[model samples]
Target: MLYFLKHKLVLLATPKTGSTALEQALAPLADMVLQGDPRIKHCTFQRYKWRMEKFIQIFEDEPPQTAALIRHPEDWLGSWFRFRHGSWLNGTTRSTRGLSFDQFVDGYLAEPQPAFAAVGQQARFLTHPKTGETVTHLYRYDAMSEFVAFLGQRLATTITLGRLNVSPEKELRLDPALRSRLEQRYAEDYALYDMALDKHPG
Candidate 1:
């Protein structure tokens, strides 16, 4: 995530949403750049605001306007599966080498998910911890050009993002029943994605 002091904007790093690539392009220009641990780098908008309270009170005088990117629910989960299945995780519990896309979705919907499918929910990640609110601005992962354009206008600078940390190519053909279960279980994710779409309807 990056904070632009001059613009009072906070760019949240939503996992599997090209955040690392944008970070590379924008970090040098940010007032504060949060990196390292995934938890910190992908900090929720609410937590970021709370964490920066003292800084805002002392310097900026108010919390920054926050924004985040989100992918389709199925696509996000598929990315997690493919990423774990990559050769880099060869012998780890996080590897999905022997699992099918259907099995991965089952594990994701399991009461106690296996490490390979235990990635956190996108909706929960974007929600405010206390107020149950969400980000001030939301962008679709598939509509990156729109997102970059919005950011360019807001920050008054061109943003040139590049591919980074891409998951390996994998065919995600989920079983009909299992896909239904996933959609039902994670309905909130789709709901939020739809909400974002409404914001920038084409």
Candidate 2:
């Protein structure tokens, strides 16, 4: 799908939202891959902010069409917390062990940091960036199949739907108190995600 575009597709990956799946699926299609810091699977907010111009520069010659994959704030944050601090993977638990989700949310809210800020802040670049105009097409992690179809049409190529990063089958049961806290913690992100979801093609 990306190979057909050659230089026309720029995938600005957002972390922990099935970005790896998208990367694997589209790797064959991309002429150049812009993998971010190894510490972060995709671009951190700081990195994206600092290199927005360079990213824009990549599109100068042919003016590539851009796309990004995003996830719901609650789910994305949970995955990020688990991946960064929890025991999901072996030997990756040193930094984040024993940190409560509330504590993590509090720390994220208190600072202007990369990878820990609100998901809405991370997603703002999809619509508006400090350096340049925002890209038009975006894919919500929740609606992968529809996004794949949309991409297929735009790129005039076939895109196969693959395994999502988060499984819907095994639902995370959050206590009411915790759910409310999370909802409050990510209110802005919820609103932004709603707007993006509304804009998605039916």
Write down the worst ten-residue block by lDDT for model 1.
Answer: 193-202
Off by over 4 Å in 1: 198-202
lDDT (Cα, tens digit) per residue for candidate 1, span 106-132:
999998998888999998888876787
Against the true structure, candidate 2 has what lDDT?
A: 0.58
Model 1's TM-score against the true structure? 0.94
For model 2, name the residue pairs that clash. Answer: 2-29, 3-29, 85-96
lDDT of 2 by residue, 28-106 (tens): 7776665545434455444544564365556565455666666777677666666555335435423445556665555
How does each model score on lDDT? 0.86, 0.58
